[model samples]
Target chain A: MNDSPVLRVRNLTRRFAAGVVLKSLDLTIERGEFVALLGRSGSGKTTLLRTLAGLDEVSEGDVQVSPESTVVYQEPRLFPWKRVWHNVALGVRTPDARRRAEAALGEVELAHRLNAWPLTLSGGEAQRVALARALIREPELLLLDEPFASLDALTRTRMQGLVGDLWARHRPAVLLVTHDIDEALLLADRVLVLSEGRLEADLRVDLPRPRDDGETRFVHLRRTLRTALGVTDKQAIAA
Target chain B: MLDAVLAQGSRIGLGGNARTTTGQVAPRPRRALHLHLGSMRRLVSPLLLLAVWQAASSTGLVSAQTLASPLQIMLTARDLLNDGTLTHNLAVSLVRAGVGLGLAIVIGVSLALVAGLSRIGEDLVDAPIQMLRTIPVLALVPMFILWFGIGEMPKILLVTLGATFPIYLNLYKGIRAIDPKLLEAARTLGLTHGETVRHVILPGALPDLLVGLRFSVGISWLMLVVAEQVNANAGIGHMMMDAEDFLRTDIILVGMLVYALFGLASDQGVRLLERRLLVWRPQAHRRG
Candidate 1:
């Protein structure tokens, strides 16, 4: 899997009139690898994801990825006027669009809501539908930007499990941007932390499969990650 | 607790049978027949007002000739219908309104697309359109008459002028109000500019555009009535003007009623089209 990088970023930088959001950064993601980007607000995590998705132009650097890449945004961003089935099948309409949409919805456990309007969906359901829409394209790469941020605690955990299950099934290389450390720890094989537009830490999670949050190793890893992020136990208590 | 409260409430209506709570009593759905009957009952007020008007004229409280009774207006309407005058005038008014409205929609939507999408286009056209929108449709009557003469052209142009601005303004607002994230998503999905406009912008703008079209249709009907009355012509408005000259109050009243009915009918047509086109939108309350 590590023989060649599926996506390579070299000196990727993005700047706005406000200031430089992502200063010269380089990262290479191997095929079928799940990578979680951890960052604080305005840490250029979303900017980098958008640039990779080709939704935003980079100020400097090269992002070389396959053209068959799809992004799931923070918001579901489904067309309000389209039904759940239609929204999932957006842009890739063929004779099999309905069949593919139904399969995707089934994968997200929203098969019963195929004909329901987008406006009627709950936040979690909508985001699941958004994920289904992105996954239906069968892309070589998938970029997710805080896709489960709006979900409640239980729903967010369930979605993290769902993402893990999907990654196991599809084996598509995923680059996910998230602020939640536990979510990054649970989902990513490796997590990269960004601070002030620079990669602060790159750590590999060597935990065993079917990892439990209550396990001693997971707890120790979380503490280590917190320390590396410069958040002391006192600061964690204060928060 | 909620179940206990519901049980107690149900017991009050059913002679204190606790076992009744265990059995699900399906709700008796209200019939559409009863709903229709209720609506008919609500129409009594309008009927009473008409009856009062009829009685006042019959009792000579007001001169019958000055203010025609409902019966007299109905009789005049029957006479006009028999002679085909009413249908002829109605057809004329409808044709003018239809042509004018079609033209307005095409021009309004095209211009709105240009103005809404391109910054340079908006800057160049927005001020001029705003200026034109401020000018009353009636104020353009003389100018249209001079340009196209007192034929059907002037009347159609008047309706067009009245209908254009609302559609343009609403369409532009709808386009601008689309969520930027949705457009970005489309770009990421590899949608070209034309495809994005077709798939994203058009559907996003449709609801507002349909609402604007409803308003525009009403405006067209109003302006058409006034425009048809401008010259010696054959229309409901012209008929009313002629009847007023001859002191035929019943015919004048009938003409006014026809104008009101036509306006309502055109508006309803627009609403029906909106319903068919925007099947995804929830049903909203509207007056008949």
Candidate 2:
């Protein structure tokens, strides 16, 4: 039971009326593993994340996600009508919700804004609230779909640290979908490159935590991933 | 796919409304200076018009038969109040409008919930309502009287029918316009369909629902007046018709004034409700 993977997908495929967006993709994430999926725009990056998040139909695949899996979307997606704590505790419809939500917001360091509405929150603060909402669900497979793609540089760095710290504390199998190369290297246990509806490279990032740009291995891994992402679709498919 | 596109379009539109109000067009000190004058400014034209009309009537430039002077109308209003005719008739109109508006709301909101929340429900409910809506509702009045006679039934039914569409259409549009990303988030959060309706769909649609209700209230009064004009036993409309027979234009003006005040007061009431319900919105309760 302990050795079982948290998420397993076999031959996943998603096709819209226009064309196939994901083509027989296979992925597995072990318990407590942190993996980052990186790709350029229109490279099936969001399509794959959405599929694993179960937002779309798995037209031709077998997917087995651990129960209580949840997604943090690119936008905060907080209900503008609801208060901060209500947004966090929305899924947990049980007694003592206030306490659990308070604790979760505390984890995200947003306890001070417990009653604040989503519209009043700054971008970084709202994203942290989103993180708190995701955490409150206690999801075994926490999917992050470009969650920090909109923040400023300074706020993005701080949010990265917060996400990293949360992942360390919770030990959930995290799949962060992003386009930022350094962001992928700075956080994930493994980094995967997806393009043309298929993952082209899955590199294991065994470097130590807080892996900075000065390390030789980090530079080499970043270069390889950049090449993998930069290559034309035909070359990627051929390789 | 179309729904997703429309949802994003609505998100962009809502972004325009969500702009910060503090540093927008008007400066604070300038706005503060006009604070009292701003409201007085609104009353300026109406009061000036009233003064001109009173001057004309007092000088007998406009005959009393053609139009009652404002002073004479006020004196008539006092007589009606003292005799209790105005109070009784006003109560009658109030009950009719209130009951009709309330019933219309229950019916409208239920139908909107059914049609908005389910595809099958939309298929079942939307077509008939749409077909019924295009026909001018006032045209149904003759048929309503033929069917139910010149009784309270037809009056209430007419008001209900007239007011129902705005509520249904606005609320239906609101539900359809909900951002798909929010729905997707709800689903991933493990919300059941019922839970989603309760927590997200209803609240998301509330702003539009209130807008519909305001329209309905206005329409309800208009319908009530029409219904009463036909054969009202006792209502403000009945008082006006009676005054028409006697050529007592002052009483007619009194009835008109009551209806006008009712319209203004009720609209303010709905606005108050809006402010209370939409407390999350920054500009919901803002006053000029």
Candidate 3:
């Protein structure tokens, strides 16, 4: 299986002025693995993602993350002034960076939008550009902070498929922070539920690619995760 | 190859759609013409008021001594133009304004960068500036005269005082108001501090800095009027003061008109610059 941990954390503790958000957490993400961390709001999924992305200082932790790591935030977080190609080339210093950015955008089917402004793009398109920007860096570990949360359902589904295809092609270790159980199940090889500042459940999906909702195992896994996250039928229906 | 074919197909489709739409875009010209007339419509009221003033003076209801008719003011302007007084004084006033406003932009932008980018600079520079802004610059004119004497120095200094605060305050606010998310993203991209400031902070603050510049330009002219009035050898204020001594209200009115014309011209100049520089802003908001 060629198992090697790309990210390792032991007793990872994060504290803000309010109090500790992540408490004595332990996690290991393997190279080329797709892991989804599911949590209800305020379960500190974002804090963990930030820590992994080197955005936040953890209070106490022994963390070993790959140097080549990038984060895609909830918002596109694109520089509004820069064109799409320019933004994709933002981290690259080479003279051929623009050509590389255009090629990356081609992979995301956004080659036509190279000269377009970020403000002019739709939510899904902007997120795709953000994905392109991250992928251009060729990060060993790609952290996503609910990158599709703001997208419409149809667009979100399309983006999920695109991400799946990209992951298969590029094979980067991905840790996606999402609250949607179906999204986690759809994209991840492993799903871990976070609660009380700890990972309460870690389950592996033995399902094949292009997972179907009609599958009995998929529904069963969904129900199990829904229960694990304390999402009652009423709550789930309302959501 | 199929992707390229699809892209080319979409481009052709878009071009065809644009061409078809262009034929149906007939109302735009009429609407634009209406907008043009709407702006020209503003001139009617002022023109009517000028007509009434000229009529009242001609009818002897308003005496020439009390108010010069628009025609008399025009004649006075012509005489000043012929004698070279108008151009010479205008050039002098413009020079003073240019020098003062230039110094203000340099000093105010420097201070704003310091205060905006660092806490220590803010604590050291912002308090004194806020204090100075409260005391009107005109009130400081007498103190300036007593300290520096009634020369070109005091006039230029007064203009500098008037122009500095708006540029500093607006630019400082602009710098502080930049999106922290953008900064975070830039840092994640491995941009150094200098690169971040150049690529993000300064460009983000530019819109507000331009607004400050518009105000500063207006203030420079106003302070020049006041400062030149104090004790001037040349400029519009000196011209007006001399006309006051001779009781040539026509020439005085001419000087005031020249000031108004210059104010309008400079303001329009700033608006043009704003349009050129801020084309990234939405179209409707970019209009002068």
Candidate 4:
């Protein structure tokens, strides 16, 4: 893979009528890199993600990226009027749209649900379908905003593995906004912490593919990330 | 086969069933026929009410001239049907309703879409439409006749005026009620303004639009009846007025029944269209 930067955000700031939500935030993502954004609620993690995805306007600074970038949201956001296959295909009407949709569903292990309606799917299944929809576009930059936050623990873990596998295959530059430190360590090459709308810490992980959750390196990275965000052991235990 | 299918699974099949081929479901047809017959039980109340009315009229509980017997009304309806009077009057009323409803949909939806999309659009049209809507439709019949003449133009104009407001109000409410998060999601996908309207806003407003359309259709029929009563030579409403003058209670009763039947039939048609269009919507307990 090329080592050039695929997405660059320089001195980005956003303000609402109430107050500033983000101030002087700068983040750069290299091609084929998986970066995790970790922060507490209201720390502007979502705001930063939205800014990067071009969903929200920035008050100052420039964001430069390739034309092919897509975001997957926390909720599936699949059209309720569409079937699974149509939802995945969305507005794409190429000759191979159906085949690509089928393959994307297969990647998410949702091939059997091709003709199923959006309402009929379980929460986990719905989120997987959403992921499949993003993947079908073959975006150069993939932004995920806590896509599995609403899933059960078992399903969340399974989805993380599925996402990791898909990323391995697609090799897109990924920026994942998440609250879970362990999830960040498990999937990202670099972990960046946002505290009070500013970049607080950035840690790089030089780990191999399919890293075990129970490994010492994984535990060390997770603890470091939690400590950087000022999350105590007591809080972790409570959670 | 019913027992087998139920035994095989209790949940409604989302994905297609693989176990059953075309030849494997023989008794299913019989069970479906039985299910339909069971649903027919719900119609018993209306039939019983008609029977009671027929008995009361036959027993002379009311004067036959004042409260027509069911047999007399039925015979009158049959005569009207055979002579083509009923069909012609029904056709005229239907045409007026159809033309008026079509115009209402176009104007109401366009105005609602504008009001929903922009603050300026909302400010420009909202107040006047609101004021216009509050004026009772029956009150407008005389004004319409005077302005447009007592012809098809006035009748159709009256129907359109009556139907437009409900659709506009409901559609505007629907547009405003869309979840902000969905729009945010669409924005993240890099959707243009027009694409957002086509893919997100329109679909989001559909359930409300359909509800408005249903109400508008009902209003159109009401307007038709009122409109036809004003210096008209044909239409069910006109027929009813003529019957009243001649003291032909049977013919008047038949006219009233025809209105009721047409309303029910038109409502059923809307329901069918709703089912076909929004098959993916979760089946709610109450239909709009």
lDDT scores of the candidates, listed in order: 0.82, 0.86, 0.85, 0.82
| Per-model TM against the reference | 0.88, 0.92, 0.90, 0.87
Residue B205 lDDT, candidate 1, scale 0-100 = 84
Return the interface RMSD of the candidates, in order shown, one decimal each.
Answer: 1.5, 0.8, 1.6, 1.7
DockQ of model 2, rounded to 2 decimals: 0.72
> Which numbered prediction scores highest in TM-score against the true structure?
2
A26-91, model 3: which lDDT tens digit per residue?
999999999999999999998888788777776697988888788888899887767889889986
- RMSD values, in order shown: 11.1, 6.0, 10.8, 9.1
Task: Give the residue spans of candidate 2 off by over 4 A.
Answer: A231-239, B1-29, B38-42, B285-288
Clashing pairs in 2: none
Docking class of 3: acceptable
Candidate 2 matches the true fold with a TM-score of 0.92
lDDT of 1 at B41: 94
Clashes of each: 0, 0, 0, 0
lDDT of 3 by residue, B121-160 (tens): 9999999987777565677888999998998899988888
| DockQ-best of 1 and 3 | 1
**By summed lDDT, which 10 consecutive residues of candidate 2 chain B come out lowest?**
B14-23
In terms of DockQ, which candidate is strongest?
2
Ranking by lDDT: 2, 3, 4, 1
A-chain TM-score of every model: 0.95, 0.94, 0.96, 0.96
Under CAPRI classification, how is model 2 graded? medium
lDDT pick, better of 1 and 3 = 3
| Top candidate, metric lDDT | 2
